[model samples]
Target: MLSVSVWPCAQADSKAQRKGRYLPEYMAHPGKMLPAIAEHAITHYTQPGDLVVDPMAGIGTTLVEAVHADRMALGVEYEPRWADLARRNVEHATDRGAPGYAVVVQGDARDIVRLVGSDTVGKAALVLTSPPYEDSLHRHVRCGHGSSLTHRNPDESFIRFREILEGCYLLLKPGGHLAMTSRPKQCGGKFCDLPSRAWQSAIDAGFELLGRYVALLSEVRDDDLVNAADVPAHLPRHEEVHILTKPANSEVVAQRVTRIAA
Candidate 1:
């Protein structure tokens, strides 16, 4: 487990340079993940030659980091443009001398089986991603601060989130791990407790809580507003990364024991 502030070299790409060109009006603003954060998570949770997956691969940060760390990476992206970018990024970061590879499939993550193939089911060593925060898909907003902004219908958004989590659970091998980054959202001038919602969803999908770590952002603009005297403080400058694991079945456990005995 990394310390709250130990993730080094965390930096955001400028919006002007994110996609290298003007995007279509319908394309949502890119919420690029920090390469350093992905690298740290990959290194901590996976081993060399292990398979790592990112269902909501945004520009391939997780894939690139995984390849750089000598882990085979598989990612699924909804948009073709972003999927292409992810492949380029992964190729640029790949070490030719290493045995690992990266594959990015352009399709909906909710249908991960079709995207990655049925053979990959129950074989991933780690599932890592920072999914789109609730709401603010078509707009840019800080984590947990946007309430009035709307993208997908509320019911649709929740269903998508739940489905994504369930998909992640289904793809993991028994005893494989899941790490996600999210924050409590603010709605109606109060905290919406999204972390708990995500936790419950993961539990419903049969994942056991392993740990939770709070990673603080360097930018305090959002926190400063929460501390303002006029408004009650409801949000924070940090995001929570929830770690979970799929329990190993008895057959899998017996196989492991026999291997150790041999």
Candidate 2:
């Protein structure tokens, strides 16, 4: 295993921007995650020895946990520097007998099938991710993060995020699962719903929702200042965890057609 590097980039500022967009690579610390991502994935989706992937591996938190839990881990990052640091961190974080892991070449998720080829690339098991929010503190979509798969105008993330989902849908083996976290834009109005656009994106990608959980920022971290701001914002706020699964062929058809045909 490669050793971790105590590099300056690994300790970069969270608010750093690239080309006017918030760089997610900068935001990838152990503290930036939603609570349910790790717990739900550990409980419901994966089994030991299975492969677990996080397309937006960030600081390698999910993959780190997956390795500790005995799942082979794979992560993809849009930023080359982050990809390097993540691999380094995961290697150092893993203990003896933890499942093996690898960080692949810096590539676009749009061609995920091409990068990893098959969903079962490393004994395919499950996927867990937290998509980037489209808007910012002022409530308008914040675009410009170079590492996001896509950065559509009038939208937050780039097109690569969509490709990641598409690739994930195609990559999971039959019975594999996916989990993600997201919040709606109308979030602070007391009437805004959990963003269903991501829900629709999952549905379109062919994963079925299993269950959901919500957690407050206080439950995960101390965000008193974020909430105290004059403008309502997502930083240091509550978030929803969405679980999805691709039903096994048996669940979908109730029987194996191949056996009947034979």
Candidate 3:
């Protein structure tokens, strides 16, 4: 458990430069996780050779970071376009001599257990991912005092999101960790506390709440932090990272007891 609350993952570089490690087309994916965020979670939560999985892997950022850190990786993406891109990114990491191996599957994360197969069930050491902000792939508008996005029925979307979290729970080994990053957003003149919603969703999916951490996405200047968004109001300075753990199962506890007795 890291006592520090904020993770300073913001880099002193332009957005294009910061994304240089990924392919050009990957920029089109709106929900892509920051590389530093993925790297920090992987480094702190898992060891070399541990398996890391990302259920909603947009363009394989988590997978790439995990393999680069010498950990095996798995990703599941629903869209065929993004799934293909994820595979290409994994291939690119392999070509660059990343020490660990990775695989990308084209399937819905709500069915993660079946997508990754029974052999992979309960084998992952960490699950790092970000859920989509709303029902849409990208924000309808990037600027303005309030959101210009259309309000759709979020009930179905949230249901699917919870299903994905439940699947992630089943994919992890006993006592494995899950790190998810999300930010609050204004939708249709109302503030949506997405981080809190995600935290509740994890709890409902059987994960024990560990701690909430902040990952800065802005620059520090003159003892003040710059806002990363170009929006005129409700600007975002950081994303909330919620760390949680799957409770150890009876089988795992019995194994530990046996080892101690031996």
Q: Which prediction has the highest TM-score against the true structure?
A: 3
Candidate 2: the clashing residue pairs are: 119-171, 149-160, 150-157, 150-158, 150-159, 150-160, 151-157, 151-158
Instruction: Name the candidate, 1 or 2, with the larger TM-score value.
Output: 1
TM-score of 1: 0.71
Writing each residue's lDDT as its tens digit, candidate 1 over 31-130 gives 6554556667788888999999998886777787788678999998876777887787666655344346899998878778667987887789999876
Give the lDDT ranking, best first: 3, 1, 2
Segments of candidate 2 deviating more than 4 angstroms = 1-31, 34-36, 95-100, 119-123, 134-147, 154-160, 186-194, 220-236, 250-262
Per-prediction TM-score: 0.71, 0.66, 0.84
Q: List the residue pairs that clash in candidate 1.
A: none
Compose the digit string of candidate 2's lDDT tens values, residues 189-221. Answer: 333343465666776666677766553433212
The candidates, ranked best first by TM-score, are 3, 1, 2
Say which prediction, candidate 1 or candidate 3, comes out ahead on lDDT: 3
- Candidate 1, poorest ten consecutive residues by summed lDDT: 223-232
lDDT of 3 by residue, 72-96 (tens): 9999987788889999888888788
